[model samples]
Structure formats: C-alpha cells, structure tokens
Target chain A: MENQQQDAEPEDNSWLQSRVAELENNWRTAMADLDNLRKRTVRDTVQVRQQERKRAAKELLTVLDNLDLAIGHAEADPKTIVAGVEAVRAQADLAMSNLGFPRYGDDQGEPFDPQLHEAVSVVPAVGVKPGTVVQVVRPGYGDAENQLRPAAVVVAKAD
Target chain B: MENQQQDAEPEDNSWLQSRVAELENNWRTAMADLDNLRKRTVRDTVQVRQQERKRAAKELLTVLDNLDLAIGHAEADPKTIVAGVEAVRAQADLAMSNLGFPRYGDDQGEPFDPQLHEAVSVVPAVGVKPGTVVQVVRPGYGDAENQLRPAAVVVAKAD
Candidate 1:
C-alpha cells in the first residue's frame, strides 16, 4: 500500500502542478484585464454623467428662457399664457426628475438648511418664526446632495 | 586626445544601449496600458450611456403617462392648457434628445426613405407623389443604425 501510494503521488503531482500553474497565469491575466476595465468604467461613467447633465441643463435653460418670454407676452391672454408657462415648468421638472433628479422645493416654511436651500433674501417675518423659510424664490431639482440646483429662498429673521 | 575619445566612446555606447532598452520597455508598457484603457473605456462608455438612458427612459415613461392624463384635463382655458401641454411635449423631446436620441420629425412632403422612416399607413395625395411622407405619427429618435425608434409615418400614394 505504501509503495502504491508513493507511486501514485508523484504521477498525479506533476500533471496537477502544471495545470495549477496554467490556471494561475490565466487568472492573473483575467484579473489584470478586470482591474483595467474597472478603472476605465469609473472614468467613463463620470464623463457620460457630466455630459448628460450639461445637455439637460442647457435644454432646460432654453425652455425656461422661452417661458420667461411667454410670461412677458401676457396681453394676448394672461391666464392661458400663465398656464402654458406652468406647464412648461412642469415638463422641465419631469425631464430633470427622469434623469434621477426629482424636483424639490424644500424652501417653503422649512427651517434654514444651507445644504438644501440658498438664501436669496432675509427679511423679518411677522407670523413665521426666525430662521424659517418664508418663500421659495426658485424651485430646485433633485435631492439635497445630488441636487441639480439649490432652491433660491427667502429666510425669515428677527428684527 | 585619441585615447580619451576611445574610452568615452565605449562608455557612451554602453550607456546608450542600456538607456534604449529601458526606454523601449517603458514605452511598450505605456502603450499596452493605453490600448487596454482605450478598449475598456469604449466598453464602459457604452455601458454607462445605456444605463443613464435607461434611467432617463424610465423616468420619462411616468412623465409621458402623466402628460397623457394632462392631455385629457386640458380644457382649463385652451391657450393656457395648450401652452402647458406643449411645454410637456417639448420637455419630453428635449429629454430624449439629451440622451443621444434626438427627435426626428421632418414635416410632410419629404421623400420616404426606408432607413429613417417607417410607414404605418398609405393614403392618396393630390400634389404629393407616391412614396412621399404624408405625416409623421410618432417621431423617431437617435440616428441611422444606432436608432432608438423609427418614425411612425403615413406615406402618400398615387391618386
């Protein structure tokens, strides 16, 4: 039994050793490829996301500017034009939201938050408490951290 | 002077030989890295773009569904309601465009090419020749071989 075992051991060892060495080489090559791919993916994702955001932002700017112009043409029909402008705003918001940036207007009556809100005006509030948001000057899109734009706001303060 | 030159020549040749070998190795490694990175970048760019487009498309689906609803509720002063609806439509178009799927809606009378236009219905026309696009039903997105959708259109037929 000892002779048989000894005879079998080296016979199996060489073949297995060669197989293991071949596998190790293949594995290392694959791992290097995977590592390179991962690094490249990170860089590409950043570039694509930045490009999408810029394109969306530029489009939004055009629509918003057009809405502003429509608002000026109020003499034709105030209610209709205003409704149209609101509709355009909603569409813009939907586009941003669709791009993983849901619309948010956290500036109305909420406590002052620098992270989410941008203070455009600070005025003493008669009814509202100090440091509370009095109004949202411009609505914002998306969440606090991933926000496309911060809400331009009016914060209340003590006289 | 001749002896000094002879000594310097050997030293210079040895240094140059070693430097050239080192530079060749470095250049080869860098070139391999660049090629690998380029290939990986292309794969990653496609993946990232598709991921972002899917995200945008998912978001747009809800907005598009909502716009369909809004279209039903569009009796709130025709001009205003229309303005709102148009804005929403424009926004959706812009969103698709931003995602590398630019809207394609060439007006009536353009010659129908099978590549860009998909004929849904055929109708007789007075002035328009057969195979001319009569109307576009749903706009196409993306361009040529990379098209996301083909234009659902009606082609004019011989009267």
Candidate 2:
C-alpha cells in the first residue's frame, strides 16, 4: 500500500500543475475581456452621442423647413407670415420637448429653488413674498439632475 | 527521508486544495465584475443618450429664440425682417452643421449621385448634362452613412 501511494504522488502533482495552468489561462482571458470591454465602452459612448445629436437635429429640421416657408411667404403678406412664424416657434418647442428637455419656467409665485432657477434680478412687489419667483427672463429645460440650463428669473426681494 | 516525504503528502494535498478554492473564488469575483460592468454599460448608454439629446436641444433653443425675435420684429419693417429671418435661417443651418448634419444638395449642373440626391423630377435642359442635377427642390443633411434625409433634386433627363 505504501509503495502504491508513493507511485501515485507524481500523478497527483502533475494534475495540480495542469489545474493551475488552466485557471491561470482562464483568468488571463477574463482580464483580456475586461480590457476589451472597457475600450468598447468608450467607443460606443462616442457613437451613441453622435447618433443622438443627429436624431435631435433631424427633428429640428421640420421646424427649420417651416421657418423657411414662413420667411418665403413673408414677402407676400407680413400679417400671415407672423402667424406662420408663431406656429413654427410652437413646433420648435414641441421638438425640444420630444427630445426630452421639456421647457420649465413661469413659477410666478412659487418658492425659488437654486437648482432650477438662476436669479438674474430681484424686485420688490407688495403682493409677492420674498424668495419667490416673480418673473422668468428665460425658461429652462429638463430636471434638476439633468438640467440643460437654469431658468433665468427675477425673484421677489425681501422687504 | 522517505518517512518525511510521506508525512508531507497530506500537507501538500491540503495546500493544493486551498489553492484551487482560492482560484475558484477569484474566477467567481471576475465573473461578478463582468456582470456588474454589463449592467453599468446598459445604464450608462441610456444616460449618454439622454445627455446628448439634452445638449442638442439646448443648442436649438437659441435658434428658436432668434426666430421668435425676428417674427416679433416683422410687423415693424417687413423688408428688414426678411433679412433678419434670412440671418436666422443661416443660424439654423449652422446649428445643424454643429450637430453634425451639414446640408447638402444645390449641386446644380453637377453629376447627380443617387446616394445624396433623391431625383424628385426630371427635366430636359439644353446645357445641363444628362444625369446631372439641374435644381434642388429640398436639401439633404449628413453624409451617406449618417444621412438625416436625402436632398430632393431635379435631374436632367438623358437626351
């Protein structure tokens, strides 16, 4: 029994060496995959950005086309062209909303939040409370975390 | 010496077993990392798309604001307003180009390429070569692979 056990030791050691080699190979492959995936992530991010820009630009083209038509007709009737231009403006707003940046502003009497509002000027009014939004100079778009721009606002001054 | 070797056999086997367990744990961790990375990739892709859309939309808002201002000024002086609207039109074109979809078409008398130009109408002209673009009905944007729309063109008919 002792002689048989001694003879089996060499085979057992060889099996271990093979197992280690296999595990090392697998670990190397996994590391390589991770490296490759990291590289691919960067490339995909750039591609995705370009794709989205192109998509949003395409949406805006309809608005541009309408503007062009309105301008071309402006030579005929200025009154009708104004109405057409207003419609085109509304279409542009819709396009922006569709692109996921819904316009937000005109919180007339709401408490001002810095995250969404930038106080460009302060005004004192009898009916308005201090720190409240009295007027929006420019409307902002999107939510707090993903905001494109803060609403330029006039806040009620503390009396 | 033989007795010492026999005694060390159990220790060597235990060490090998521990090594195998450690390797298995490492492999599992790498797999978990890969799984987590995949989930992050999906989340990041969505984030990137939204970010790009927001950015592109923000760029468009200035153009829309300019259009609104031009329209508002239209009633005062219709002739000057036409020039103002023309400037706004140029601004819109720049915005599209900035967004990576520069306008194409208006290649009058140039050899018509089906990839960028859509033959909307055929015209027989005396000087224009056969299969050449005579007039552009509508302009296209972007390169072939990333085209937003094909330019609608009038191609000269084969004589």
Candidate 3:
C-alpha cells in the first residue's frame, strides 16, 4: 500500500504542474489579445470618422455643383436663377437628410418643446395655444436624440 | 524515511492544487475582460460615426443658410444674385476643406495624374506636354488618400 501511494503521488504532481502551465499560457494569450484589440479600436475609430466625413462631403458636392450651375445661368436669365437657387436649397436639404440629420422644425402651430425648439420671441397669437410654436424663424437639423441645433422659433405668449 | 515522505507528499500536492486554482481564476478574469472590450469597441464605432456625421452636417448648414439669403436677394437686384451665389459656392468649398477633404484638380497646366483627374476627352495642344491637363471639366474633392471622386478633365493627347 505504501509503494502504490508513493508511485501515485509523483504522477498526480506532474498532472497538476501541467495544468498550471496550460492555464498560465492561456492567461497570457488572452492578455495579448486584449492589447491587440485596444490598438485596433483606435485605428478603426479614425477610419470610421474619415469614412463618414467622405460620405457627407460627397453629398454636399452635388449642392455645390448646382450652385455653380445657378451662377452660370445668372447672366442668361435672371428670373430662372431664383428657381435654380431654390432647387439647390432643396438639394442641400436632401443632402442633410441622406446624412441622417434631416431638416426639421418648420412645423407651424405645433406645441413648443424645449428639446426640439428654441423660443427666440414670445407674442400673443390669435387662435393659438400659449407655449405653442407660431413660426419657425430658422429651421433646425437632426433628430431629438442627436440634434445639431434646436429650431429657432417664435412662440405664443402665455396670457 | 517512508513516514516522512508520506507526510511531505500530501503537503506538496495541496500546494500544487492551490496554484492550479489561482491560475484558472486569472485566465477566466482575462477572458471576461477581452469580451467586455470587444463589446465596447462595437458601441464606440457607432458613436464615432454619428459624431463625425453631425460635425459635417453642421458645417453644411451654414452653406444652406447662405443659399437661402442669396435666394431672398434675387428679387432686389438680379446681378447681385450671381455674386451671392458665387460666395456661397466658396463657402461650400471652405466647409469641405474644414471637414478634411479639400477641393483640388483645377490646375490648367499641371501634368495629369489618373489618381486625381479623370480624362473625359483627349485634345491636341501646342507647347504643352502630352498627358497634361488642358482644362478641368469638373473639380474633385478630398485628398489622394481618401478621394471622393477624381476631377473630370480634358487631357492633351499624345501626337
């Protein structure tokens, strides 16, 4: 019985040693993976910003081209230039929409919400509720969650 | 001697078993960290893209506002509308440059490079090298590293 016990002890020790070595290797490998992932995240962030900028710039280029066309036509027909400029404005709005920041806050008679509208002036308005947006002085862009700027508005005065 | 060896064997075995347990715990902790980092990287990528889009969109809004101003002045003086539109075009160019994609490819006498200019038509030229850009049909945006589109050009043909 003593001989058997002595023989089994060395084998058990060797098995435990191998397990410790394996676990140590695994821990080191995981740490290295974490380091590499951190480096890649930095690089990917710059890449994503560059890509988004390029996309938005491309959309703006169409508006620029239309503006050039309007300027070119300005001498030939002054009346058409207004229509051409309006078309370009629409194109710019489309560009903003395509970039996920659609133009907003042109709605009249809507209830005023500070999250979406900035009241520039308050006046008593007929047939309009107090704290309602009577007019949008300047339209806003983007959604409620990621607004670039709140809509400039004239709100009805509280009577 | 056998009794002493028996007593020492159990002590060594227990120590080895403790070491294995500690190493296993460390490995699991490292794996969990890696998993958390991977999830964070995904969230960060979306955030970076949205932030970049918002920045570019904000720059474009100024150009849109200028367009609106130009349209509003169209009725006051027809000739002033041309100059107003031209200024707006310059503002759009500035917006693109601010976003890191400057306008390029309007050089008349520069040697044409396929990376920056696309040859729309080949024309014979006097006192100019072959493959030189005689005229830029349309300008390009962005740098060589991340071009939105190449400039459309009329290149001098080889004689």
DockQ of 2: 0.41
Judging by lDDT, tell me the better candidate of 1 and 3. 3
lDDT of 3 by residue, A69-91 (tens): 88788768767888899899998
Sort every candidate by lDDT, greatest first.
Answer: 3, 2, 1
In terms of docking quality, how is candidate 2 classified?
A: acceptable
DockQ of each candidate relative to the true complex: 0.06, 0.41, 0.52
TM-score of the second chain in candidate 1: 0.51
Candidate 1 C-alpha lDDT tens digits along A59-140: 4444444554555564566555646555655665666665666767755878988888889999988798899989987666
lDDT of 3 by residue, B32-107 (tens): 9999999999999999999999889888999999988887787777667878988899999999899887899767
TM-score of chain A of 3: 0.89
- Residue pairs clashing in model 2 are none
> Second chain only: TM-score per model?
0.51, 0.84, 0.87
Who wins the TM-score comparison?
3
**Could you give candidate 2's fraction of true interface contacts?**
0.53
The C-alpha local distance difference test score for the whole of candidate 2 amounts to 0.81
How many clashes (backbone atoms < 3 Å, residues ≥3 apart in a chain or on different chains) does model 1 have? Answer: 1
Model 2 deviation from native, Cα RMSD in Å: 5.0
